[model samples]
Target: MQLISLCSGSLAALGAVLFAYGNGLSKWGGLAVLLLGTAVLLLSLSLQRRQEKEVTRLHRQIMDFLAGKNKTPKFSVNDDLFAVLENSVVELESRLLLERENTRKSSKRNADFITDVSHQLKTPLAALKLYCEMDQARNLGAHSQKQLALIERMEHLIYSLLRLEKLRADVYELQFAKHDLSRLLEQVWEELKVLYPEKKFTIIGTAELRCDAYWLHEAVKNVIKNACEHTTAAGHIQVLLETSETVVTLSIEDDGGGIAETELPKLFQRFYRTAQTKASGGAGIGLAITKTIVEKHHGTIAAENTAHGLRIVMCFPILDGVLAAG
Candidate 1:
């Protein structure tokens, strides 16, 4: 545009000079006319150049911000030639960015939900699959027997996944029931013995804890399962259930090497698994479910590296109805 304007003015100046000389007009008049045209051309060229540079800079800044690279304060354009376009582009970009962030949050939520649904459907499917794959014949063939055992293992995993899924869906899906907390621990330990015969899980301390019985059982079992998965054969896992006037503490620990300090904060996040357990087949929902269940029961859970290993500390609030005066 600027070049066009300059070229047109030069041509007009030449025409004016020729006209002045041919028609015998004053030469200074033609010169003044040419100078005025030249000044107008320069002004237009300068404005166009400024606009082009501003547009280029704005494009670069937007790109940088989108890629999370440049954080050089938001481009403020209260007034300018591209002000309207800038405002429009910025508003559009903000909406797009907000949408992207919302998309990420929604995706995570869907992933968690799908995981929960898949888990809920696993148990019955596992039981059915196991029953179908088993050899019912009086004399079972070796191959069929091996297949049956494999089916059983897979079925168990499916059930575990389902339970873990339910835990994630709602930690307190199972309502509280009046029972001896000690008894529930014993039952959970007995179940663990069958699941992990090679490990030694010792339960210590006494006193009844008030909690949602089934979900608490699931939380305890999830912790035990975590320990079993990470520990070697005959590895030591301990469970301590302690009760005071106001709070109940349940601690589970293992001799296995603790989690990385960086990953510690995310231990309770759904589908987040540690490097050590990645090789081992696990859905990675156990601890997350445990945390959910603990929270559902109005309890607090935390993790820390102990002298020998990792310790999970759980605290539950005791609920006692207010006393009624006579």
Candidate 2:
């Protein structure tokens, strides 16, 4: 429309100039031409502004639709392209919402199944443990002793599985508070020390963060215990704490030969054990539980092979309010 208006105005100006020239009115013709050009420029500017406003309106509508702020967008009947785009966006949003709902239902079903199975097994497992205890009390033979040990291990595995599923399903409540990280690490080390007295454990620094002390202890203990299992007797396991304005990082490094590079990504997966770890009798739920706990605290955990051995790092964000309080 703007282009046609400009072309028509140019032709009119040309005709007026020729008429004025023939009638000896060149000055009037010049003024008429200037007026025509000005009108055409104003019209074009008006058309451009209207087009821009239409585009801005369409963009906002699309954004609102996608954000679920608006369920139905007002479509422009005059603009076929804009209408088509709006329909496409609405379709995409519908598909995304459906997929999300399906995923949520599936996760809930899986969590419920795990919870039910864990509950069912607990009763029989308790009975089995009791029976084994009774046999041991009667001075059962070595074979019975081994069976009792296996049963205990199985009980532990079942408990760990339930805990992992609860954490993953967000049913586990974490009590968050500002706690001294150094003291927490010390507490974990104290318990681990009794289990693996041959391994050397050290805490090198201090920090304080808002976290669930109990769950965080569980996470840290699991990592350190895994480190102990992988390391040689008398190997050094160092826990380093470092804090910055934005993050607090806790690193556990051990002199155990690091995991294979190919298996690094699978470390946090439930029941995923490398050949070496499988031989060590790990059910592989520890790291998975640790990852869930860290994520629940809005933190990140990663494992990497260091020059000396393996380093598992957990980094927690320092909230603005916490920084201010500090």
Q: Which candidate should be chosen as best, given TM-score against the real structure? A: 2
lDDT for each residue of candidate 2 in 1-326, tens digit (9 for 90 to 100)? 66866685785677567656655566666667657766776777787787778679877765565445765444445556657766776677677668756865776677788889988988988898788788888876556678888888888888888888767665666666889999999999888888888899889989999888999999998999999999999999999999999899999999988989998899999999987789998888999999988887778999999988889999999763332211
Stretches of candidate 2 off by over 4 Å are 1-107, 139-142, 320-326
TM-score of each: 0.51, 0.65
Model 1 regions more than 4 Å off: 1-173, 321-326
lDDT (0-100) at residue 90 of candidate 2?
Answer: 60
Candidate 1 residue lDDT tens string, 141-185: 556666666666665555555555544444223445455767887
Please, what is the whole-model Cα lDDT of each candidate in the order they appear?
0.71, 0.81
The ten-residue window of minimal lDDT in model 2 covers: 317-326
| Model 1, residue 155: C-alpha shift (Å) | 8.5
- lDDT of candidate 2? 0.81
